[model samples]
Target: MKKIILLSFLAIICSTTGCKKFLDKVPSSFVAPENYFNNEKEVNTALNGVYDILSREQTFGGQLPIRHAVSTDESFFSYASFPTGPFYYNFGADDATIRDLWRYLYDGIERANVLLANLDKANMDEGKKSVVKGETLFLRAFYYFILVQNWGGVPLKLTPTTSINNVNIPRNSVKEVYDQILKDMVEAEGLVKKISDIGFGGRVSKSAVRGILARVCLNMAGYPLNDVAKFKDAATWAAKVNEYGEHALNPDYSQVFINLCKDQYDIKESIFEAELYGSNSDAFREGGRIGNENGVKCSASTDLIPTVGFAYGFVSTTRKLYTSYEYNATDASKRDLRRDWAIATYTLNASGVKANIAATNIYARNCAKWRREYEVVTPKNKNYTSTNFQILRYADVLLMLAEAENEVNNGPNATAVNALNEVRRRGYGKLLAGATNPANADYPGAISLSKAAFLKVIQDERARELCFEGLRKSDLIRWGIFVNTMQATATEFTTYAAMTTTIYKNARDAAQRVTATHLLYPIPILEMSLNKAMVQNEGY
Candidate 1:
């Protein structure tokens, strides 16, 4: 199918890079500022260029999605162009992508600055200029957030077109960068009006800014080890998003994932999404990274899901998680229809659930999360036609709100509980799009969960709700229990019965426990080759 999509958005005083590989010696190709700001359209096109670069495989369209490679078992030595190879090695603090992330992001920074610097001269309506400014500020902060999260401290670039030559800039502490991020996003939060702009999917939005701010705060609260202040900040930002009232969870949870679903742009659940639409009819790529599997088999049958060996591996779920399904699943009323449809497992069929299908051809117990698509142009290529990557779902925001609020013990607060309940309600075929009391809370010695219990609930909910959406590993990291959980999950793969479970352990850990350093990926090799001044992190 020829999927039609256009990505652009509302803006006020906003605006927005690349060079030949050899000519890259210059920090940037300076176009005369006079000629640069020739028209409002010129500035708009400049920002479009930013979107263009980000959509490249090197950034979001392809390579960035593989971020799960380091976290999941669904990967192996890519016979193809492997962009994230360094991550698996536990590459140093200064790898190229790390540095390229610096450069690519700065490239965005300069573009945003250009717009902000020239906002006054723009010929567009004054209202439009403010919208543009809001967008630019959001983009700027968004890029910096990516930087600080990945590289810790990075030199801040507010608006330095005067000296593109300043390559010797020392790194700013992570805290400083975060401060800037907060400042810019805060401004963005105010300036962006509700959008009716064309092509808004994946474009920045008011709620998107709030969601990122909340997420950033949440990360800061947890990363580098949990800080009480960070938690407070996290809660505050999350609350800001909820309080601001720009979004809500859709009534249906599965509606969030199905490619065929409409109102995708209108779905209250999508705070932000990556827009992917392809209508190519080309032959399988020869030299270039065409469809961006990065030369690796993504969710390869044996690698990610459905492999008995991989299933039983420690990465597999414990009987604990499986039990969560037992509690929440609708299969008891026609069991397999609910759980069976979510995760693809080999089992025989029964009323409430399907028994594990007995078939050797069964690749593994895998998540049905992947959107398997058929080829359009070239018959050989298999594509996942889903246009929207649910990067930040509205339900997640609600649950996050619930977590932050509940942590303070203020209340499961009606609204917060509503948000959490909404997810389960949709999943279990209920109307209420919020959390509810577990049926017979005291029944049959229920798994007692205190405040911490919600954490596990969220984590398992991630498994059931997100699954193969390229989030589990990061969730594992953020939940702050990758090593223990992943290790136990890994060892579970050792037994015959466990093969269907994700119990396999990654050998990288030798029992001393994986360090927080593992969370930050090393900069790419290319970046180190380019910037000698860039310091490498210990243990490449």
Candidate 2:
């Protein structure tokens, strides 16, 4: 379906933007917007174009999911020796990766604007049209949310940019951008289809909008904005999803990701994901590096591709993440199942056998959540795997609700504790819908913890459950502890790392480089040059 849409989009692009028809008078000229978007097909094509940006390499396709989100306490670049890069955080605004991410996100916004601006011209079923409009609005707001979260305040471009000359827009305040996001997303919730109606997690659904809205509110309630009122709003939105009665945690914790690797949608658990397809063994080049870049290390020359697809294994888990999962210091039976699944315990060797990583070397394990071994698309490309990267999940929604509820009520109410316990029960592999697991109690004595201690539990729970799914850095930033956390991580590396190991120096250096300035990425140098009213982020 994605391939067909993308191919159609390419055809439309060619027809409208100067692909030649040799028999025509103006063979390679432009087709004005007035002539296009006269039918539902045309408008749908344009909408798919906007959705395409979400899977671009600069966005969820790779950098944002891996490099941009890692280097935090959860994980780090396996090859961190590079002194300056997104992973190292020692780059300037002129850095190409930063500029590319900024451009891609804005490109998504612009595409959404173009579709929405011209949507009314199409003669389609009004209901279908409204859903399309709702999707576009949600996407535009989401693009802005990413911008605001990363750069603090960015130029809010709403209307379509019809010309190249209009480039000097002023930046909006963070509050203003967030307000616009809430307004658009709230309206979108009313217009978009429900997850059950959609039958998949790839496209925008009411639950997706509400879940992300809750996330946005949670962000506002923290860090720079510090809008405590938003906590209630966040809880309200999350409760809507929880109470929707359709979604639930997939019984097996690891199977949740395994389903993603196999391109199967468990809409019950995965609320939304970037639809990644095709291995590029054919003409469709839309696949992503979700598993390949972050999968267990496998060499093309040594490991047989047919047995275990090649993965550069560029990203690895931190000791902090390995230790974050609940486990008794001496007993193995008290272990959390999420730890081994989240962090690989073995790597494939030259003969394609499992080379188990020693228990002592926790930091050496790769992120195992998105393993490529289960990828069903055969003849897989070494650089790309057809693994759909989940953006929102029911477990995450539960955690968000618990966090926000705790904040709003000044303690963990029954609802909050139960919501949190659902996730904890799943982690211990004891959550069967109606069955009792007397052997593994839910949180043991969670109810007795004070508000402060419960908040700490929520924080650790999020890391243990959702590490390397690309929320850790933003999570730390919102908690107003990114710098302190990274600095402490550096101390840990200094304390635990062998003095002679390269990881000791590199990991410590990367962590130490983080400072107040890293709270938000810089406004791209290209944007600064074009928009005279734009200001660079502090210390950039």
Candidate 3:
């Protein structure tokens, strides 16, 4: 669907811009806007081009696999080869992944610009027009946000067309990118509507936009980059979500990832997520909407076993993170069932494997959070895994709100508990459907908290609730303990084993510990090669 639309965009864009069919699909020529927006289908096809860019792996599918994996200790990485697994796994910036990420995200920006610039000219149903326009704006902001966060200051291009007359540009400051992000969010918030729009599986919704706004503000509130003044604003955005009352916590943590993973558009806890689709009913795969077919891939997760990091066996877990769990053996044996969800941290089938079955061989603490949708088909389809990428979840919103409230109200207020406990209640199979803050136990005005003390709880709560969702690295960074915590973890984790019952090997080492260069990702080589105006990030 997206590929067909992209070709249309190329054909039309080339015809109008006098671009020779450099890629064959787009003819070198120029066609005026008047000719392009002749009808709704044409307008929609153009809009779909914006969606197509997102389907590129750099934006979601491919890049996610890198950012989510490299930024943490989910696996042991090797950095020996100049630009292969060894290079990237070692946090080296000159790798293909980094370069590809740069090209892909910018490609997304270009696609968005083309769609947005001509959207207003399209004569489509008002509702459909608004939805498409709103989604493009939201997605543009999203791709830029990824660039800003990962690449720091980046070239901020909101409009389309890069003719010889308009090619010169410079990297915008991070603050500028952020300001643009907020602007896009505000616009999107007004435009987004129903969660279930026709074929809008991954389209931005009002809740999703608001959710990202809240996250943007929350990230601004933490330390070195303390936009402390935004804490109140953050609370306000989160409160709007709470007041709107459309989403709520999922009762079971496991359910959040499994059965209910799809249709996460307006999930109570889901803020933003990347969408993946298996093209054919064969369930193998076409190509992802994210265009992941572009390159060589690495192990899906950091090693999960306690053995050798790259052996594709054990996915090691740090002992410190494992022991953080508080067990209550006296009561219902399922104390801290959330621990089970952290696949690399606990034993699932601890009993001796029954001798006759394959079940016994299934011993590893690695993340079981995957799917085997395809048995055969494309080569990549065979290695294809069913783990959907999640960007923002509501629990993070509640916790962020709790932190913001604790800051604004100056302590763990009843409101903070209401937000915090709402998430936990779901964990315990409880719902806040009709319950009010302060519960029945405490008076609202009487509760409060000290900033210092409150921050500690908020940090712990983030870890307890969002352990392996790829926020660990950033959370520690936000809290100012990223280096200390990660290094200590690697030390204690050196001898750690992924499974208790299975005897494993190879994971004994002190290879890729957190370092100074890790503060930011390096600029991709392709960006430098393609965009002469681009600059490499520090220490690449």
Highest TM-score against the true fold, candidate: 2
Overall lDDT per candidate, in order of appearance: 0.49, 0.82, 0.53
Summing lDDT over every window of 10 consecutive residues in candidate 3, give the lowest-scoring window: 305-314
Tens-digit lDDT track for model 1 on 244-341? 45565555555555532222465356666655554222321111122223211232332222211111111222233344454434333222123444
Ranking by lDDT: 2, 3, 1
**In model 1, what is the error at residue 254, expressed in angstroms?**
2.8
Model 1 lDDT at residue 75 = 23
lDDT, candidate 3, 194-304, per-residue tens? 443322335577767877787777766763367788788888887776556666677667666653223233355554556554433243232332211211111333232
Supply the global lDDT for candidate 1.
0.49
- Quote model 1's TM-score: 0.73
Candidate 2 structure, TM-score to reference? 0.94
Off by over 4 Å in 1: 1-33, 68-103, 160-164, 195-200, 225-227, 230-233, 236-246, 260-264, 280-324, 327-342, 345-363, 374-386, 410-415, 432-449, 495-515, 529-533
In TM-score terms, candidate 3 sits at 0.75
Best-fitting candidate, measured by lDDT?
A: 2
* Model 2 misplaced stretches (Cα beyond 4 Å): 1-5, 8-29, 300-303, 328-333, 432-439
Off by over 4 Å in 3: 1-35, 53-55, 65-70, 73-89, 164-168, 196-201, 260-271, 279-316, 344-364, 371-381, 385-387, 430-449, 495-512, 530-532
